[model samples]
Target: MKLKLLSITLLLTLAACKSHAPDASGPGTAIDPPIRPNPRLAAATGFDFYLLNLSWSPEYCHSHPEAAECASHSTFVLHGLWPQNKDGSYPQNCGNGPGSQTGPDASRFSDIYPEPGLLEHEWRTHGTCSGLSANDFFSAARSAYQSVKIPSQLTNLSSQTSLSPEQIAALFTQATPGLSRESIAISCGHNYLTAVAICLNKSLHPIACPAVRSCRANSVRIAPPR
Candidate 1:
């Protein structure tokens, strides 16, 4: 009788242990943690900041009249988003990923890069070094472009205008709240305003770009969009 009682107690204890055992395929099961990408690896490879290049379409179209972007009569169009070092040197062709291929869809950037060739060239030459996929890199470029506020005078010029590089930089600074003279650099070719380059941090905030050479022309002509 005692032996029978002891067996019953042991069986009950075993049953209780089995019931309390952690279930691998049931509720309350502990799941494995998800893998995460490394933060440092996800960022642009060893770049100090970004240089957002904005080309004056009228100036560009004057030389390349056949370019598709000229048809839209845009004032300021995207040139390229370049990864630059603090010393002004930049990286190019860092990888041969999807950005280097011709397959990545670029229709979404028609307003920014009206020329399809320019889109592919920029991605292969500059975006490849950005440490982001083609989509993310272009998205960043688009966002950076949209953040800048073009001055009303430049955007709505009804006639040809001329201004000093310093004056142009001042106009940009006044239009963009956080932009400053030190952060803006103007480029000119043959007395025509060609492009405006703005320096920005990884987070796309305006920053000083002392290394970029600003146009030394005393006065540069601004051609109205044709």
Candidate 2:
């Protein structure tokens, strides 16, 4: 076990180092990610789990009414699909990928992530580290999200609802039979529910994440999408 853990750590360090090397492009130019024929990284390193961050659109829209996502009605939205190391350290911008990617397809991402640059940003930042291509990474994110159902109580909430972190976690756990109390976390800001992140292994199956934490608030108000 000790040797395996050490090997995982070393692999992670190497992958991280390789990714940060300045691109051959030029002194200040950003590196572009290779269009992968096969995107899934062959094996795991320090990245032992995934975090499917589902944001409550209402809470986000309530504060930033001018945000593009606020322009339309949405329920839960994809905040990010994060790769997390067992020890809690995670990778970001781990590839010599293009700084931004955009197009009609990106605009279509409004179905879930409505902000203008968010989809592009997420792909370049966190998605690159997943060892998946732009399409595959996003596909995996969508699959991870679709595999579970959002509790109806959280949807279309007309009034602010107060609940503890444990209560929020329980909703997710109950909705996804495969998920457990240990695999879910809730986060809040400005006294309102912001996001719920569920941990998964590379297979996108629920997994234990000792390092993931719940919201600090004993109770929080959740605002539905405006």
Candidate 2 lDDT, tens digit per residue, 40-117?
543545466778787777765665666665666667777777887777677876654322243225654556565445
> Each prediction's Cα RMSD?
26.4, 13.4
Which structure among the candidates has the greatest lDDT? 1
lDDT per residue for candidate 1 within 23-133, as digits (tens), equals 112101111112222233235556888888887878766656666777888898888778888875777666665445643367887877766656766676678878777
lDDT values of the candidates? 0.69, 0.62
Question: Model 1 compared with the native: what TM-score?
Answer: 0.78
Give the RMSD in angstroms, all C-alphas superposed, for model 2. Answer: 13.4
